[model samples]
Target: MSKDRPAPGDRIKPKKSALVQFTATTLQLEAFVVAFAAVALYGLRDSLYEKGPLELSDPNVIWVVGGVLVVALLVLSRLTAKPVGLAGGTVAQVLVIATGLALPMMYLVAAVFVAMWVAALRLGTRVDRERREYDAAHPETAPNV
Candidate 1:
């Protein structure tokens, strides 16, 4: 047996699979977005209630939510350093912004925004995993590899 190999009775083992690790990293990236949304919502709630300066009423809530969605999308794109989900995210974001302006469709806007963000997060996780696997498989390759 190789000297570096674990003994037959070794007790330690890693609990997480690659999927779990990818999920955890994706969630970690989203957590920052969630935190930022919470802070922005708390700070601007009064202004989004139709009585604020924008006069957009409930529409302002959409703005706040959309803002968070966009920021989160940007962060994910940057973290992955890939354009994989950017186009889809941008489309969803545009839908959010437009739907918000309609004033009475806040729920739909929120739902779509949430769906898009989740999709983007998943895409990021996949990208991260694929990249990691590629690096592992090509560990010793130079530019020609």
Candidate 2:
């Protein structure tokens, strides 16, 4: 058998480095955050209408619109690259914040999501840096992919 060939019963598999894995995970988490917010707001639409101070007869409109926007942005973020994903996440957070105008509780929810977004970006960057340093120090271990 050739040196490059795997022996019988062996399988060749593509390997994702830590940096790639972390980046993918972070993006997915960001998307999930917005998606969760959309679903939650939609679920609480009736409650918000009943308890919120908004004078509109159909407060569910706000919830539905916001949910749609967040869900759309989440889909776009997942389909695009890092910059688009980050921007979409930011916009989704802003939408969440804007919901505070209708229901005050959204302010707290927005803040929590914002915190999570920041943590994901910062920690993912740190992980990327470490992965780069490791790759630089040990080039042989780096994956071809």
Candidate 1 regions exceeding 4 Å error are: 1-102, 141-145
Using lDDT as the measure, which candidate wins?
2
Name the weakest run of 10 consecutive residues (lDDT summed) in model 1: 48-57
* TM-score of each model, paired residue for residue: 0.32, 0.63
What digit string (tens of lDDT, one per residue) describes model 1 on residues 27-90? 3454454445445444555554442223333545646765666576545444443344444444
Q: List the residue pairs that clash in candidate 2.
A: none
**lDDT at 71, model 1:** 70
Instruction: Give the CA lDDT, 0 to 100, for residue 1 in model 1.
Output: 66
1-145, model 2: which lDDT tens digit per residue? 7876556555535443433344445445644655565565556656544444643335467456755765665575454345765676666667767766655666786787677667666776687678778767955554444
